[model samples]
Target: MGYPQVSAREQIIPSRVPTDAKANALEIGPERTVIEITHVGVTAEGRAVKVTIAVAPVHYLTAGYELRSPDTRRSQTDDHASR
Candidate 1:
Protein backbone atom coordinates (compact mmCIF):
# COMPACT_ATOMS: atom_id res chain seq x y z
CA MET A 1 0.00 0.00 0.00
CA GLY A 2 2.89 2.37 -0.62
CA TYR A 3 1.06 3.64 -3.66
CA PRO A 4 -0.43 7.09 -3.96
CA GLN A 5 -3.89 7.88 -2.66
CA VAL A 6 -6.95 7.67 -4.89
CA SER A 7 -9.01 10.75 -5.63
CA ALA A 8 -12.54 11.03 -4.20
CA ARG A 9 -14.11 9.74 -7.39
CA GLU A 10 -12.25 6.45 -7.15
CA GLN A 11 -13.10 5.70 -3.53
CA ILE A 12 -16.36 3.78 -3.89
CA ILE A 13 -16.72 1.25 -6.67
CA PRO A 14 -14.37 -1.44 -7.91
CA SER A 15 -13.17 -0.81 -11.44
CA ARG A 16 -14.05 -2.65 -14.63
CA VAL A 17 -10.81 -4.46 -14.76
CA PRO A 18 -8.82 -6.27 -16.35
CA THR A 19 -7.44 -2.75 -16.72
CA ASP A 20 -5.90 -1.68 -19.99
CA ALA A 21 -2.15 -1.05 -20.06
CA LYS A 22 -1.83 0.59 -23.46
CA ALA A 23 0.94 -1.14 -25.41
CA ASN A 24 1.84 -3.14 -22.32
CA ALA A 25 -0.83 -5.71 -21.57
CA LEU A 26 -1.61 -7.01 -18.08
CA GLU A 27 -1.89 -10.80 -18.02
CA ILE A 28 -3.73 -12.45 -15.13
CA GLY A 29 -5.39 -15.77 -14.36
CA PRO A 30 -4.32 -19.42 -13.80
CA GLU A 31 -0.70 -18.34 -13.50
CA ARG A 32 -1.77 -16.31 -10.48
CA THR A 33 0.56 -13.55 -11.55
CA VAL A 34 -1.85 -10.87 -10.41
CA ILE A 35 -2.61 -10.07 -6.79
CA GLU A 36 -5.65 -8.09 -5.64
CA ILE A 37 -6.51 -6.56 -2.29
CA THR A 38 -9.88 -5.13 -1.40
CA HIS A 39 -10.84 -2.82 1.43
CA VAL A 40 -14.32 -1.66 2.39
CA GLY A 41 -14.70 1.18 4.84
CA VAL A 42 -15.62 4.79 5.45
CA THR A 43 -13.48 7.75 4.48
CA ALA A 44 -12.50 10.42 6.97
CA GLU A 45 -15.26 12.60 5.51
CA GLY A 46 -17.68 9.77 6.33
CA ARG A 47 -18.41 8.45 2.87
CA ALA A 48 -18.71 4.69 2.48
CA VAL A 49 -16.07 3.18 0.25
CA LYS A 50 -14.86 -0.02 -1.31
CA VAL A 51 -11.48 -0.24 -2.95
CA THR A 52 -9.52 -2.93 -4.78
CA ILE A 53 -5.91 -2.86 -5.77
CA ALA A 54 -4.21 -5.09 -8.30
CA VAL A 55 -0.52 -5.92 -8.31
CA ALA A 56 1.55 -7.71 -10.91
CA PRO A 57 5.16 -8.12 -11.92
CA VAL A 58 6.12 -5.85 -14.79
CA HIS A 59 8.75 -8.27 -16.04
CA TYR A 60 6.24 -11.02 -16.74
CA LEU A 61 3.60 -8.80 -18.36
CA THR A 62 6.07 -7.07 -20.63
CA ALA A 63 8.17 -10.14 -21.20
CA GLY A 64 7.35 -12.81 -23.78
CA TYR A 65 3.58 -12.77 -23.96
CA GLU A 66 1.60 -11.63 -26.96
CA LEU A 67 0.05 -8.45 -25.64
CA ARG A 68 -3.71 -7.98 -25.77
CA SER A 69 -6.09 -5.26 -24.56
CA PRO A 70 -7.84 -5.77 -21.24
CA ASP A 71 -11.18 -5.91 -23.09
CA THR A 72 -9.84 -8.99 -24.80
CA ARG A 73 -8.36 -10.41 -21.61
CA ARG A 74 -11.55 -9.74 -19.61
CA SER A 75 -13.54 -12.12 -21.76
CA GLN A 76 -11.03 -14.89 -21.24
CA THR A 77 -11.46 -14.50 -17.50
CA ASP A 78 -15.24 -14.35 -17.80
CA ASP A 79 -15.31 -17.45 -19.95
CA HIS A 80 -13.24 -19.36 -17.47
CA ALA A 81 -15.34 -18.16 -14.55
CA SER A 82 -18.56 -19.32 -16.22
CA ARG A 83 -17.32 -22.92 -16.28
Candidate 2:
Protein backbone atom coordinates (compact mmCIF):
# COMPACT_ATOMS: atom_id res chain seq x y z
CA MET A 1 0.00 0.00 0.00
CA GLY A 2 1.09 3.55 -0.74
CA TYR A 3 0.62 6.65 1.38
CA PRO A 4 -1.22 9.61 -0.05
CA GLN A 5 1.03 12.45 -1.14
CA VAL A 6 0.68 15.81 0.49
CA SER A 7 -0.19 18.38 -2.17
CA ALA A 8 -0.23 21.58 -0.18
CA ARG A 9 -0.27 22.87 3.36
CA GLU A 10 -2.22 25.87 4.56
CA GLN A 11 -2.27 27.81 7.84
CA ILE A 12 -4.81 30.42 8.86
CA ILE A 13 -4.17 33.00 11.57
CA PRO A 14 -6.73 35.21 13.18
CA SER A 15 -6.51 38.99 13.08
CA ARG A 16 -6.16 41.01 16.27
CA VAL A 17 -9.21 42.67 17.68
CA PRO A 18 -8.98 46.35 18.46
CA THR A 19 -9.30 47.26 22.13
CA ASP A 20 -9.17 51.01 21.83
CA ALA A 21 -9.97 53.09 18.78
CA LYS A 22 -7.90 56.15 19.57
CA ALA A 23 -5.02 54.31 21.18
CA ASN A 24 -5.05 51.62 18.44
CA ALA A 25 -4.40 48.76 20.79
CA LEU A 26 -5.26 45.05 20.46
CA GLU A 27 -7.41 43.26 22.98
CA ILE A 28 -5.03 40.33 23.18
CA GLY A 29 -1.32 40.99 23.64
CA PRO A 30 0.98 38.94 21.46
CA GLU A 31 3.53 38.55 24.26
CA ARG A 32 0.95 37.01 26.59
CA THR A 33 -0.14 34.10 24.41
CA VAL A 34 1.10 31.26 22.25
CA ILE A 35 -0.79 28.89 20.02
CA GLU A 36 0.96 25.70 19.05
CA ILE A 37 -0.64 23.63 16.32
CA THR A 38 0.36 20.22 15.06
CA HIS A 39 -0.73 18.29 12.00
CA VAL A 40 0.03 14.59 11.69
CA GLY A 41 -0.58 12.56 8.58
CA VAL A 42 -0.88 8.78 8.89
CA THR A 43 -0.87 6.10 6.26
CA ALA A 44 -3.51 3.42 5.80
CA GLU A 45 -1.14 0.97 7.48
CA GLY A 46 -1.27 3.10 10.64
CA ARG A 47 2.19 4.56 10.24
CA ALA A 48 3.06 8.20 10.72
CA VAL A 49 4.11 9.73 7.42
CA LYS A 50 4.44 13.46 8.05
CA VAL A 51 4.13 16.01 10.80
CA THR A 52 3.68 19.81 10.73
CA ILE A 53 3.97 22.38 13.48
CA ALA A 54 2.88 26.01 13.70
CA VAL A 55 2.98 28.67 16.43
CA ALA A 56 0.91 31.80 16.71
CA PRO A 57 -0.74 34.19 19.14
CA VAL A 58 -3.50 32.99 21.45
CA HIS A 59 -6.00 35.36 19.89
CA TYR A 60 -5.56 33.50 16.62
CA LEU A 61 -7.37 30.47 18.09
CA THR A 62 -10.81 31.63 17.12
CA ALA A 63 -13.74 29.49 16.03
CA GLY A 64 -13.67 27.85 12.58
CA TYR A 65 -9.87 27.96 12.58
CA GLU A 66 -8.17 24.95 11.00
CA LEU A 67 -4.79 23.73 9.79
CA ARG A 68 -4.70 21.02 7.14
CA SER A 69 -3.24 19.63 3.97
CA PRO A 70 -5.60 19.47 1.03
CA ASP A 71 -5.34 16.62 -1.47
CA THR A 72 -3.79 17.76 -4.75
CA ARG A 73 -4.47 14.59 -6.73
CA ARG A 74 -7.87 15.72 -7.96
CA SER A 75 -6.55 19.06 -9.14
CA GLN A 76 -3.70 17.40 -10.98
CA THR A 77 -6.10 15.12 -12.83
CA ASP A 78 -8.30 18.04 -13.76
CA ASP A 79 -5.34 19.91 -15.22
CA HIS A 80 -4.38 16.99 -17.44
CA ALA A 81 -7.93 16.56 -18.69
CA SER A 82 -8.23 20.23 -19.57
CA ARG A 83 -5.15 20.18 -21.76
Candidate 3:
Protein backbone atom coordinates (compact mmCIF):
# COMPACT_ATOMS: atom_id res chain seq x y z
CA MET A 1 0.00 0.00 0.00
CA GLY A 2 1.17 3.52 -0.79
CA TYR A 3 -0.61 6.19 1.29
CA PRO A 4 -4.03 4.76 0.49
CA GLN A 5 -6.02 5.14 3.66
CA VAL A 6 -6.50 7.27 6.75
CA SER A 7 -8.95 5.88 9.34
CA ALA A 8 -11.33 7.78 11.60
CA ARG A 9 -10.36 8.33 15.22
CA GLU A 10 -12.31 9.64 18.20
CA GLN A 11 -11.00 12.81 19.86
CA ILE A 12 -12.35 12.34 23.35
CA ILE A 13 -12.31 8.84 24.85
CA PRO A 14 -13.66 9.90 28.23
CA SER A 15 -12.83 8.23 31.52
CA ARG A 16 -15.01 8.61 34.59
CA VAL A 17 -14.30 8.28 38.29
CA PRO A 18 -14.62 4.78 39.78
CA THR A 19 -17.14 5.71 42.43
CA ASP A 20 -18.93 8.55 40.66
CA ALA A 21 -19.78 8.91 36.95
CA LYS A 22 -20.02 12.72 37.10
CA ALA A 23 -16.42 13.25 38.15
CA ASN A 24 -13.50 13.78 35.75
CA ALA A 25 -10.38 11.66 35.62
CA LEU A 26 -6.89 12.81 36.56
CA GLU A 27 -5.30 11.53 33.38
CA ILE A 28 -7.46 13.66 31.07
CA GLY A 29 -8.00 17.20 32.21
CA PRO A 30 -11.28 19.12 31.75
CA GLU A 31 -9.60 22.09 29.99
CA ARG A 32 -7.54 19.99 27.55
CA THR A 33 -10.45 17.75 26.48
CA VAL A 34 -11.03 19.46 23.17
CA ILE A 35 -8.19 19.75 20.66
CA GLU A 36 -7.81 23.38 19.66
CA ILE A 37 -5.10 22.85 17.05
CA THR A 38 -3.63 19.97 15.11
CA HIS A 39 -0.64 19.41 12.84
CA VAL A 40 -0.46 16.74 10.14
CA GLY A 41 2.66 15.39 8.46
CA VAL A 42 3.12 13.24 5.34
CA THR A 43 6.03 11.16 4.16
CA ALA A 44 8.15 12.95 1.58
CA GLU A 45 8.99 9.59 -0.06
CA GLY A 46 6.28 7.22 -1.31
CA ARG A 47 6.39 3.80 0.41
CA ALA A 48 5.25 0.45 -1.02
CA VAL A 49 4.54 -1.28 2.35
CA LYS A 50 1.57 -0.79 4.65
CA VAL A 51 2.09 0.87 8.01
CA THR A 52 0.14 0.05 11.19
CA ILE A 53 0.85 2.01 14.34
CA ALA A 54 -0.49 1.01 17.74
CA VAL A 55 -0.16 3.45 20.64
CA ALA A 56 -1.12 3.19 24.30
CA PRO A 57 -0.90 5.54 27.27
CA VAL A 58 0.91 3.94 30.19
CA HIS A 59 1.35 5.65 33.54
CA TYR A 60 4.44 4.47 35.39
CA LEU A 61 4.04 6.82 38.33
CA THR A 62 0.65 7.95 39.58
CA ALA A 63 0.38 10.67 42.21
CA GLY A 64 -2.08 8.81 44.42
CA TYR A 65 -2.09 5.05 44.82
CA GLU A 66 -1.57 4.56 48.54
CA LEU A 67 -5.28 5.04 49.23
CA ARG A 68 -6.51 2.40 46.77
CA SER A 69 -7.42 -1.03 48.09
CA PRO A 70 -7.64 -4.32 46.19
CA ASP A 71 -11.44 -3.95 45.99
CA THR A 72 -11.08 -0.43 44.66
CA ARG A 73 -8.92 -1.66 41.80
CA ARG A 74 -11.57 -4.22 40.89
CA SER A 75 -14.31 -1.61 41.03
CA GLN A 76 -12.37 0.70 38.76
CA THR A 77 -11.95 -2.06 36.19
CA ASP A 78 -15.66 -2.89 36.40
CA ASP A 79 -16.65 0.75 36.11
CA HIS A 80 -14.44 1.24 33.06
CA ALA A 81 -16.07 -1.72 31.28
CA SER A 82 -19.64 -0.73 32.22
CA ARG A 83 -19.30 2.87 31.09
Evaluation by lDDT, superior candidate among 2 and 3: 2
Per-residue lDDT for 2-78 in model 1, tens only?
33433233222222333445224554433333433344445566565655554554333332335568798799999
By TM-score, the best candidate is 2
Question: Which tens-of-lDDT digit does each residue in 1-83 have in candidate 2?
Answer: 56874443345443333224312333445344455556677656556678786655564465574554346767887899999
Ranking by TM-score: 2, 1, 3
* Of 1 and 3, the candidate ranking higher by lDDT: 1
Deviation of model 2 at 58, angstroms: 0.4
All-Cα superposition RMSD per candidate? 17.0, 10.0, 18.6
Off by over 4 Å in 3: 1-67
Q: Quote each prediction's TM-score.
A: 0.22, 0.39, 0.20
lDDT of the candidates, in the order given: 0.46, 0.53, 0.36
Candidate 3 local lDDT, 1-83, one digit each (tens): 54643322223223222222211433443333222112232344533234333222222222232354779889999999999
Query: How far out, in Å, is residue 51 in model 1?
Result: 2.0
RMSD, candidate 2, Å: 10.0
lDDT, candidate 1, residue 58? 36
**Candidate 1: residue 5 Cα off by (Å):** 12
